[model samples]
Target: MSKQTQETGGAPKWSGSFGFIMAAAGSAVGMGNLWRFPMLVGESGGGAFVLVYLICIFLVGIPLIIAEISIGRAGGKDAFGSYKALNSKWGGVGILAVITSFIGLSYYAVLGGWVLRYIFVSVTGLPKSSEEFFVSFTSSTGSQIIYYLVFMIITVAIVVMGIQKGIEKSCKVMMPLLIVCLIVIVIRSCTLPGAGEGIRFFLKPDFSKLTPGVFLSALGQVFFSLSLGTGATITYGAYLGKDQNIPKSAASIAFFDTIVAMIAGFAILPAVFAFGFSPESGPSLMFQTLPAVFDEMTGGKIFGVVFFVLVLFAAISTSIAFLEVVVSFAVNTFKVSRAKASVISAALITCLGIPCALSFGIWSDIKIAGRTFFDLGDYLVSNVSLPIGGILACIFIGWVWKSKNAEKEVTNNGRISFKLVNVWSVLIKFILPIVILIIFITSNPWIMNLFK
Candidate 1:
């Protein structure tokens, strides 16, 4: 808390816990929840996926979140440095965490570009409907690259402005706007004809669809949606004060994140049902179906504009958080200035993002493990980086680090009785590790199809 401790630490303290919460929430509430969650739900059989996803959030997501935050606060450093500082045995894992963040940001920015493109179209009233706009946009290679560049540039510029002025400021405005817009869209969608059916479809738990494949999908969604294993959470936690309650903060973040996702599902599903369209339209569900639904509504154009803007806000906020992990890692490990780290990280990620930008067009033919360039990037991050990073984090916190130290850091001035600590210990030592390992081994395509 002293000037010497603050200055030597070199990381900016969040203005307050609220700013930190919004920034963290902004990171978690991104394209995955808005664009990907509904599609996954539809594909895995509506309510079944939702049920399993919620279970995963509590079982796996909560413990790992606490571990990550505890580690970050304990180290009081950036992602890689934090891990390395914790113990030398974790240096490689720390570096992998850094790699994961960079890899995630690479393709993430490309998709963020797609959202940016849609935002402009929403403002200009071009393409008319989501379906038409997406078809036209994906039909050409040149346009996708141009739009991708625009998105990356915007992301880099914001990151270049430094954390307080750039990342925190943007989230303060964008997060509130995102919530307000989402509320309006949900209200409108609920009024549509046949909206009841859509709500029923989402809420009804079809226990029959609770297959292992569905479970894995839900697990993956929970991890990806929360931006776990990407070091974003770790870096955000590093900015916290000792008095911040780790468990309470994690629960709040998870609650808001899950609620926003559900709200998005509510907003989109009713409209999809009203339009008699399949909700399993994959990633393009939002881009294609929602616009058509809006087009038929009374204030379609206005809502369409608002929705795309919301998407842009979600994408940008998440991207900024993702970029922050890489920037923080660089600054902490190499002892570099924030400006240098930002530019270097941006340039590196931009180069890595080329294939993702071209995945729909020029590099369309490129395939690995039966996926396109973009798919490969996504798979690498979700299946490889995330699960692995999460596993290592759990092990480090539960086993590697001194238990008394971790317990003190996590509990701080607040009293966490032996019983609660025991429960957390059991989770980290037994439940979480085994589950993560099972998911990692079974995440293979062959194993997945066996369940199908």
Candidate 2:
């Protein structure tokens, strides 16, 4: 309830935990869940992937999430500042967090541009096919650049408005809208002819297909999907009041994010199956499949427009959160104004985005270890920054900080039984770090295959 001066300090404390939940949900429920989850489920062998993903969410995702949020609340600063504030020795880690987030948002905005382009296309008319549409869109470098600029500008503008007014307020609106739109899409997908088959494909667990690769993929998805790494969660947690219940709020955010992702799978996979298309189409799965379904449905054009609009909302919200992490780091570290920090950060990101944007065109021929600029960025952030950052956060909270101090700070006036704290401690200290490392080691095969 206490108001903080926006210019001199950070935004005011969130109105309550509900606001925090919404903000955290906004960060989590992005293009990853809506646009990417269905494709991953389909490609990774349906139920096998979903089952592994669930395991990863609990074992690795939750503990690390708690650690990140706890660190943020304790430091009361951006990712970099928080680490530096925690210990000067860990300042380099904070810098890595900031840079990782920057790399994430850079290409991430380029993808947002693709989403915006799809939104426009959906309004006008659904594209013919994924490959053709992608080729045509990429061929026109001018339009791609323009769309990328528009997406970046919108993200930067929101960030410039400050957190409470722009980031928090906008998410409160967008997150709910995203949920509603997803629900509607799911309902419509269910009504499709032979939709039941898609449902079975997604929900029916096939234990036989389970493998280490599938488990690792699921874990990586859960970690990346929640926006757990790169210090975004911690930065958001910095705005929380001492009275907030960290465990309960984190659980709520994780549950909501998971539910939306599951619903999205229902919305997408059913339609893909109903249309008699392959779900294992990788990144092109959504682009290739969804448009065909929309083009075939009753009022398909209207539904397509709504779908892409929701996708755009999800992409922009996530991009805004990523940019905020970088902007916050700049402002807190250098003691600069928000406007100056945002502009500087945006300029730097835009420059970094150039290679990512061109990855579809002029830079298409260039490859690092047989991966494009976009792929390299995605790999570095999702595989390295996120998992490692999470590992560091857990170690700091569980081992570096005194247990009594953490319990006092986290619990506030509320009485959390010692048993729960003990459980959390064990998970943070041992289980979570080991799981993340295992996933990181296993995720390399996919990258290795890219080279082979």
Top candidate by lDDT: 1
List per-prediction Cα lDDT, in the order shown.
0.79, 0.78
Tens digits of lDDT, candidate 2, 1-452:
34332423544466667777888877888877876777667667677777777777777676666677877887788887777777667766667788888999888888788878887777777546666887788757787788889999999898898777888888888888888888888899899998988888877767766776666678778888898777778888888876677878788888888888889888888888898876754457657678777877887777787788778778877888888888888887788998999989999999988788888887898999988988899989887787787777767776776555566666763454334776777888888878777766666677567667
Score candidate 1 by TM-score against the native.
0.91
Candidate 1 residue-wise lDDT, 234-273, digit = tens: 8888888776677877777887889888889888888888
Per-candidate RMSD, Å: 2.9, 2.9
Highest-scoring model, TM-score? 2
Number of clashes found in candidate 1: 0
Q: How much is 260 displaced in model 1, in angstroms?
A: 0.6
**Alpha-carbon runs more than 4 Å astray in model 2:** 1-11, 39-52, 413-419, 445-452
